[model samples]
Target: MYLKIDERIFRELFHTYYDRLYTGFYKKTGSYEQAQDLTQQTFIKFWRYRDSYNPELSVEIQLFRKGKLVFIDWLRKESKERQMIDSLQQQEKIPVEELSADLKDSLNQAIDQLSPMRKEVFNLAYIEGYSHKEIAEKLNVSVRTVETHVYKSVQQLRKILALIFIMLHL
Candidate 1:
């Protein structure tokens, strides 16, 4: 109930179970990189909640349960993103070249509001079409970090664009 996983034990467990977990995740997700990311997410969850480990329960069960959750969250995020893109497409109706200069300026302002690192990540990801792994390697940060910045930046930009659309319509 209150078992704490010390570094040595954690390392042992990680080494022993990592491949199994990775294989399981890959089987479910059918993507090597996604499986790796989900595996890392599950281990990160385990490390954060190490004190909550119930010794009576099987470690495999607990780890897989966390993996299931991580996968579910990833799915939900992906769904929301897809919906956002669809909604934006429907709302735009106007072609990019036809967008008013005012709208373009507002979009620029929204991007300008992002943190410097996030702005760079967003540009690299969406503008320059860099992959998340490429951005991570270029920035010398983890893939998760690049993913987070890009996700947050897109969400922020969407909100701003929605506001701008409303204002323009009004």
Candidate 2:
């Protein structure tokens, strides 16, 4: 059954349910910015997929379901990234003091070699302690893109650091 929903009805639905959706996301995420972002994305997805929605289900149900999926995907991605970082840290185990002045310079030089967007994303995520979502919003990019940049930056840094460590030992 194709249910045609007009713009007015869509706007009304958005206004009626947006607060509740935002609240639910806020409780789950514990971050206002992330909650807002999730809420916005939920609505965007709903609008995009409105044609396929089952008329039998309430709008609230559809929105909440999409929101849950978005939240779960976020958690899974974050978990994977966290594990990668943890593994890297354990493997490298480099103390800051152990890095000689030349090694420190080499690290900086390696960072400078990163592409501009990757460097900016890396700095925002690590140096500024911003979450991937936060960096995405600030940079007007997707969360997945931010994740990629961070992952690549870490890989590059690890490689450079490893080489420096080996050179220092020799």
Candidate 3:
């Protein structure tokens, strides 16, 4: 069977421009793997939106612009994660090493009290540094479900720790 016009154009575009786009992304990102991922995402976007392609304009220019947007989105996501970590540190002035042994035990116990799935999600997000989307993909669940698990886990930990502290004081 003959290929459709859009499919033929995409195959030609991918073969001709993939390496060039990957080089540009690598230079901007300084990570070979990330550059490859960004380049692949750009092509995926182009294929998905092939109907919107404007024949009058340069397809190469459009692909490059899409890559730029993807990079900006990645940067924004990283910034938000950094800010959250910074705020958590700011809220707790005491370093983890300085925490008393009893306090450390309390924290461990609090985490252990969580449901198996919630505990796993908490560890992935907090200890493993995985994003919500990544955790969802790894667990084969929806992003919203991952978010809910993490949110509830945090809330449960806070309450459990607070009770432990009060009981220890009394």
Candidate 4:
């Protein structure tokens, strides 16, 4: 079985889909700008794939599914951008005297997995440039323990970040 889609039919189909796709994305994401962007992108996909339209597959269903994926991709990109921005803000608040960009990105990934006390001690010692004695006094622990936590935390954060770097390169 074969179907021929003319320019008039394509225009009509596009007209019917444009509003529905925008509404679907608006409901999913609650952002008019994002919805409008996805709506335009959906039509671009429509134009690019016009020759492959399959009447048996139900054009409306296909369009809806493609539009949904586009909206979801946008959502993922927006979420990642927010995370990167937050990490940058956190890094900025730490004084420049103690920061290394590679170390900060590593610490962000590893700090969450540290024990609460170790995280506190390690941040003071490395991020705030506090000595072991000062970190110990601040956290009310012995200097030896503060030194140990900083040593361990640095080792673990480096390993965690090495894996992240490898995965990114691959």
Best by lDDT: 1
Give the alpha carbon lDDT tens digit for every residue of 51-158 in model 3: 776666687887778878888987897577556544553553344567789998998899999999999998887767788899999999977578768767877999
Give the poorly placed runs of model 3, Cα more than 4 Å off: 1-5, 93-170
On residues 1-170, what C-alpha lDDT tens digit does candidate 4 reach at each position? Answer: 53456788779888887888888888876778778989988877766777776778887877777777777787797687556534533553456447678756655777887878778876786567776678888888766567557666666766877887787689
Model 3 weakest 10-residue run by lDDT: 85-94
Q: What shift in Å separates residue 106 of candidate 3 from its native position after superposition?
A: 8.4
**Candidate 3: clashing residue pairs, number:** 0
Which candidate, 1 or 3, has the higher lDDT?
1
Candidate 2: list runs displaced more than 4 Å.
94-108, 114-152, 156-170
lDDT of 2 by residue, 87-126 (tens): 6435533554677788778777777988899889877876
Write down the TM-score of every candidate. Answer: 0.61, 0.61, 0.54, 0.50
lDDT by residue (82-137, candidate 1, tens digit) is: 67545543542334456688987887888998999999998887667777799999
Task: Please give the range of 10 consecutive residues that has the lowest summed lDDT in model 4.
Answer: 84-93
Instruction: Tell me model 1's lDDT, rounded to 2 decimals.
Output: 0.82
lDDT against the true structure, per candidate, is: 0.82, 0.80, 0.81, 0.72
Q: Per-candidate RMSD vs. true structure?
A: 6.5, 8.1, 10.3, 14.4
Error of 1 at 165 (Å): 9.6
Ranked by TM-score from best down, the candidates are: 2, 1, 3, 4
Q: Say which prediction, candidate 2 or candidate 4, comes out ahead on lDDT.
A: 2
